[model samples]
Target chain A: MPAIVTTGITKSFGAGETRTSVLRGVDFEAEAGEMTFLVGPSGCGKTTFISILSALLSADGGALSVFGTEPNRLKSGDLVRFRRDMVGFVFQQFNLLPALDAAENVAVPLIIQGVSPRKARQRACAWLELLGLGAHLGKLPSELSGGQQQRVAIARALIHEPRLLVCDEPTASLDAETGRQVIELLREVSLNPERAAIIVTHDDRIYPYADRIAFMADGRLTHVERPDPARIPARPIRGETQP
Target chain B: MLGIALKMLFGDIVKMLGLVMGIAFSTLLMAQQGGFFIGLISRAANTVTEAQGVAIWVMDPKTETAEGPTAMRDVELYRVRGVEGVRQASPLVQATTTLRTPQGRSSAAAFLGVDDASLLGINPRFVVGSPEDLRRPDAIALDQLGFSRLWPGEPLATGKEIEVNDRRATVVAITEALPGFTAPVIVYTRLSQALSYVPGGRNRLSFILVEAEPGRDPRAIAQAISAQTGLLALTTPEFQRRTIDYVLNNTGIAPSFGVVIALGAVVGILVTGLTFTLFVNDNLKQFAVLKAMGLSNWRLLGMVLAQALVVAFIGYAIGLWIASGFFDAVNQPFSDLKGFWLPWQIAVMVAGATAVIVSLASLIAIRRVLRLDPATVFRG
Candidate 1:
């Protein structure tokens, strides 16, 4: 089974006279061990599509199945548990809780998964170390540079070893060099045979790192492509489960 | 989670400080008013309470203690002794006498005249002179407080002469500090000397004091006395209640304290509610962040309620401290006003009231937090 499948998903904001459709008949899928990219200009519904895939927004019309379970069919509490257990999200703005230190921010996913704080901190520290952020674990988000904050966000996304990682413009706020480093980290995380990542980005500089790239126009995906193998290096999967 | 709640509660020191002060002031006012009211009520009954071994007080049916004079026949003393529980009974005369003093003929003095045998019912702690001193035909025991007013600069020596009812009487001994209704008191001879001062014949007395058998209920003995003699017999509590009822019905004290107590309660509820409301509003963003982190609505509410509890407890402590200082500095002089005495139960009640007020104030903010869309954090 695919890591994520959405058939004929549609969404609209407001109601009646003021209703405006933001997504229409969007069908998408991401395979295991693949780094799929959704590239589009501003206001093209790339972020909205990722939101639905991450279970943060409910599609008005769709069959959304992540890891063979329908997200919309779950109750409120169960939906939260499902999202915490099955998905990790990295946003464009690096939405780290400002009051928490870097390690605490990275531990949030594990906290949501009901891990004890001590165990969660240990796991988060390991991820931060893997992401080259070991020295900055004790600093707060405000104290870190943009590049360091993005790395912390990336560490948080992969801390719980979620089956599917949904990232919305994960590298948009970083410089080209820092953005490339972040993309490479995401690419390495997606090398697991049973885990996948769907990243939404407007920046074209990081497209070479994507295993498969899907282009979106307006509210629809218009094309898909495989990046040149020479431009991307093979990476060893460090934290994936064997299936 | 509770630790998180405490951190949230104390994180904003300014708002927390405001809430503490508000609650503290309310509690302090409540404790002060309640204590003073009780102390004032106790003063009206002190005269009767100090008289020991008197189980039943016989007063006229139409008379209430402290309201007006109650006259009973001196002959009723014999009838009261005829009851089963009654061991002895005595006729006592209470009259207000004017004494010529350095303070321009001092105000009316509470004069008690009792037979030599019944004088033991008076305060045993009489300072300098014994009750036997009042047995002398021309002698009287003056209260210690009375001498300061009567003599002013003169020393309170034994056998100092004072004019009572324009008749010269020697102060045989000075009694301890026993203040009476309206002013300090003097104890004089009961049989012939006391009756001669009254306008009527010596056969008339103010009231009869009845002593009952050991282990007898005062109320029951009072009923027995009232049944045999056609008079109203009252226990100590009943007498006190009658006096309090008379004062409340006849004086302005009830209305004044009643209004103050009511205002205090209203201000307490409003101030606490408003303070807590502003506190919650200020933390709305923090609440939204917590809600977005998958915290249930009930957990968030618990945190807010915990904050309120901490504020109330701290406030109550400070308020009590302030009230005690006020009482020590002011209230004890005019009346026998005592310090604030708060029981554990009363503290719990105050805390419960504070919690209720805080919970109501938090409802609006809690609803807002629960309804917050987690997606907003992503929007900006």
Candidate 2:
């Protein structure tokens, strides 16, 4: 079964004359154990579609399911629980809280789930150790470089072990080499038979890592294709499971 | 999460200082003004409070306060003394006169003339000399503040000669008395000398200070005296309360203090509300990111409340410390503000006001948070 499946997902903003349609109808699917990249020009409704898929937003009209559960039909409380237990997100800004150290920032999800803070920090430390950030765990986001901050954001997203990871423009702020490294780390640690990852990006340098690429323009998915396998780099997998 | 909230608030030093200062200034102004008002109003009843054993005060029906009395005929004293439950009735006179120091300086002074034999209404805590010293010829007792004002550099000692209403008077004792609202200089002398010194009509007795029998209720005795003698009579507490009420209702002191206190609260509310709102707005994006991470709106509300409470508590503590310190410094001996103090009730009142301030500010700021769209995090 697909990890996420949506048909005719629609959303709009404002009212009366100023009503702007950002997502007319978006139909998309991603199976478990695969990395699907949504590629499009700016304002193509790519972010809105992922937001709907992850339950960060509600669709004006659509049928949506994540891992056999339809989110729109769930009660408000149930929907919040679903988002908390099943979804993870990474933003383009690497939005680590400026006041918190790296480990504390990465510990946010588990803390939100009501885990003891001491244990959350322990788990966060293990994740940081796996992602080559063990030396930077005590440093705040502003104390680290762009690549390091993005790594901390990725650690925060995956620390809860959610089945569906959604990342929007995760590498747009990094250089080519560091961006490729982050994507490599995200896939090696996040993909398995029980989980899937979806990344929204306009950065073409990381395109070879996507198993399937969906193109969006003008509020709909225009095309979906399998990328050439030869262009993908083969590297030994590391940090495949929770440390 | 609450821990995170506190960390967030304390992380910005300049903003935290601004918030603390707003609350502190409000509290200080409120407490200080309230203390001053209480101290000043209490002075209106100082004579009543200082008269230790006088249970009932008998005056002319038109006399409302202790400051200015309509003199009753000397025969009215005998009438009050004949009332049932009146153990001892003594004639007490209150008058104002001008005093001239040996240095040739002059100032107005409040005069109290007690019964010469019993000295029933002249009870005072002596500061420098014994009460026995007032028994000497032409002797008078001066309040410590008055002595300091009349002789700025002179030590408080006996054998200081002064003139009252052109009559020679000597300061034989220095007594500690609560300063009055209008006159800080208080002079205590015998009834014969006060009548001889001040120019007045044939009626000389200002009040009859009646001490009720041990088992008698002072209020009942006062009522009996009033009914039989055709004079206004009141228990000590009643007279004190009436005096304070007269000061509050008939004077501008209460309104003046009230305006200042109201302005302090207003300034505190405005400063704290605006600064707190700005603080939240600056961190709005961070809050949105938390919301998008599956934190419930309820938990987010709790976090905001936690931040607000922390600020209020810290600010209130600092303000209260400073205000109490002011009261302590002024309450020293020889200071004109010797009787002023910060009451715990005022602290509690300021605390309640602080709560209202923070709640209003948090309500305004949290509306923005509650209405925030978590999807906006994706926009950045």
Candidate 3:
């Protein structure tokens, strides 16, 4: 089964004359073991769609499902649990708290899972080590380079081993090389047959990292394209699971 | 989760101090000033405090305060003595007179007369000559506080001489006596000598101090004395309360302290309210981020309360310590702050008030945060 499925989803803001539709009757789906890129112009509904899928926003109508559970059917508490246990998020701002060191920031998800603090920190350290950040585990977000900070954000998102990861313009603030490194890290560390990752970006330079790039405009999904490995210089996938 | 909340609270060092200081200042001011007010009112009853062996007081019907100099006829003492349950009745006199300084300067002095045989009303504590020295001819025992008030530069000695009511008098002893709000210069002399020093026509007895016999109720004896003698007879505790009540009602001291203490609480609330709201605004985005991470609203409320508790505990502890330190520094036997104390009742009251102030400030900020959409982070 697909990791996420949205059928005729609709979301709007304001009332009467000032009313505007941000997402209008959109149907979209994302599969497991793949990185799906959502892209379009700035005012397109890319962020609105990503927010709805991340369970941060409620859809005005239609059905949405993640891991075969329809979100609209879940109560508020169950929805919170679903998001907590199954979904993770990465932000463009690298929203790692400046007050916490990299390891502690990554440990937040496990802490929220009611894991013991010592064990959670140990798991966080292990994850940071896997990403080559063992020497910088104690550095705060402000003290790290852009690529390292993004790596910490990715570690935080994957720490609880959530099945679906949604990233919003994750490389928007980094330079080209750092952005490439961060995208490669996400691709290397997150995709698997039982899990999926989504990146919403306007950076065409990172397009080769996605298995499929979906185009959005005027709150509607218009097209999706798969890159040809024989044609593009994009690194071909070597495995279906995280290393 | 609580660790994150605490880290957020303590990381902002400047604002955390601002919050703690606001509550601490209010607590300190309320406790310290309240102690002084209590001390001042207690001093209004200094006459009753110094008369140790007497349990009942007989004064004129119209006398309302402890320091009122309503005189009674000399025969009234015998009448009070005849009351049932009265073990020993002493005719006591408390009157104000003037002492003439060597420079011809005059200041009002409190003239106190005791029973010549027993000296029952004299303060037992003395710093210079003994109590017997007060019995010599034209001899007087002036309190060290009075000596200092009457002669600011003079040394406390046994031989200083002053003129009372233009008559020759000598300070034969220096005794320890707490200065009262009404009478700062206290002079203890014999009843006959005070009669000469203070001029009163036909009525010289200021009060008939009575001691009830053992196994007898003083209140019943006081009532019988009042009914038989047509004078106001009151137990010591009752008279002390009346004096304190007089100070509270007739003087503005009670309301004045009340206004200051009330202002302290209000200022505490305002300081915390403004700063906490500002802190919330600065961290609003972070709250949205937390909410987006699926932290339930209930858990967020817990985090807010945890922060408030931490601030309240630190602030209240420091405020209490500083007030205690200040009281220890200034409290002395004869100083203005004598009998001053930060009572535990007042401390508990201040603590309750501090909790209220802290809770109100935190709840106001939390209300705004709870209504925010976690999706707001998507926009910013």
Candidate 4:
């Protein structure tokens, strides 16, 4: 089964006689171990789609299931636990808590899951090292470079080993080279047999990292494109890569 | 979570300091005023309380003590002794007399004509002479405070001569520090001597002092004395209530303190409420961030309340400390004046008021926080 599936999902803001639809019968899926890319112009409902898929927004109609569990059926506390335990989100602006250092930001998911600070920090440090950010763990978000902060955001998203990783324009704020590096990290983290990732971005530079690319326009998926294996060679997989 | 709450609380230290100061000033005022008011009430009753060993006092049925004189039959002591639980009854003539002093003659002195046996009601703190000094026909015992007022720098020696109501009397023994509200008391001989100096009607004594058997109710003795003697007999508590009623009805203290207490409470509510409202407004964004970070609505409320509690506690501590020092320093030389007492109940009241004011102030900010969109955190 796919890691995430949304069938004919729709969302609207406001009520009775004053409503505007943001998403219209959107159907999408992210298979395990695949890096899926969602590319669309602004206001195309890409971000809203990711929000729904991550259970942050309730669908106005139809259904959304993450890892076979219907997101809306979970109780509030169970929903929080589900989000904390099974999903990791990376935002475009690198939304790190200003009061916390880089390692603390990365450990947020584990902390939300009630892990001890020491163990959370240990896990955060390991992920930071994996993302080539070991030396930047102690620096606050304000003290880090834009690229370094984005790498911290990436590390945070992957630190808890969430079953599905969701990114909303994660590289839209970074330079081309930095954006490529982030895309590489997302691809590597999602390559594990038990995990999947869906990244929504306007930037085209990260397209090469996706196993399958879906294009969205005016709140609808227009096309799906698989990577051209002939144009780029795949590297020897490490960690828990899928077969 | 507690750490998060503490860090958030301390993040706006300046605003919190303002809140603390406001609460502290109000709490201190409340504690001090309440303590003083209670102390004043106790003082009004101190005349009876300090002489709690005396079971009953027989007075003219017209009014309470400290009013005008209450003349009762001088022979009523015999009738009082006949009652059950009656141990002894002593007749004393209490009158206000003038004392001639070097500085000038002072008026409104409380002169008591007591036999040696009736000295049981006098507080032993009266230092200059023992109760036996009243045994001499011409002897008088002047309180040490009264002695200071009378003689000034001169030594209060035994056999020193002083005038009472223009009648010559010798200070056979000088008692120490016993100043009553009506006058500075000078204990002299029995009803005859007191009448000779300040003569009133015949066969009348100012009041009768009654003692009862151990564990006997003073109330029962007082009732019996009134039934038999046809005079107003009062237990210590009854007399104290009468004294309080006199003070409340006659003195300006109750209204004055009432106004002050009311103003303190109003100022506390307004100042604390306004200051806390401003503080919450200043930190609304931080509250939004916390809410977005998955803190429940109740948890967010707890955080604001925690801040309020910390402010109230710290302010109360500082205010009470200062009030205690001020009360002690001011009432020190005048030891007769009782100092303020900040009991736990008053502390709780002050703290609780502060918390309520702060919580009311935070309602607007809490509403704003609960409505925040976590999606906004992604926007910027």
| DockQ, each predicted model | 0.25, 0.73, 0.59, 0.21
Model 4: per-residue Cα lDDT over B1-380, one tens digit each: 44445555665678778877877788778777877776676555554665536778777788566435577665677777788887877776767767775446564567766645566555555456766766777677766666656665676567777676678777777654334555534354555577777767775576677888888888988898889878888987788788788878888888888788767767766777787777776666555444444445666677777777777778778877877776666553224453345566766776676666556656665666666555554565
The superposed Cα distance between candidate 3 and the true structure at residue B26, in angstroms, equals 1.7
Candidate of highest DockQ: 2
**lDDT (tens digit, per residue) of candidate 3 on A6-105:** 9999999999999999998888889987899999998788888878887888899989988788877778887777777888888888777767889998
What is the C-alpha RMSD, rounded to one decimal, of candidate 2? 1.8
The regions of model 1 sitting more than 4 angstroms off are A32-51, A89-158, A164-236, A240-243, B48-50, B65-69, B90-116, B120-207, B245-271, B324-336, B343-345
Candidate 4: list runs displaced more than 4 Å: A34-47, A91-108, A121-158, A168-191, A198-243, B64-82, B91-117, B126-207, B245-308, B335-337, B351-373
| Candidate order, DockQ descending | 2, 3, 1, 4
Query: Pick by TM-score: which candidate is best?
Result: 2
lDDT per residue for candidate 1 within B1-380, as digits (tens), equals 45456655676677788878777777776667765665565556666766767777887776677325577776777888788888778777777777764335564577766765666346666667777777776777776666766665566666877667767667877766345545444454554566665456544677777787898887998987788787899987788788777777777876787677557656766877787778777666556544544555666677777777787778878877776666667542122232224445545655565566556655666676677665554564
Off by over 4 Å in 3: A230-243, B97-109, B127-130, B147-157, B167-176, B184-187
lDDT string, candidate 2, A58-152, tens digits: 99998998899898888877777777889888899998888889999999999999999899999999999999999999999999999999999
Give the fraction of reference interface contacts each candidate recovers: 0.13, 0.59, 0.35, 0.07
lDDT, model 1, position B217: 86
CAPRI quality level assigned to candidate 1 from its DockQ score: acceptable
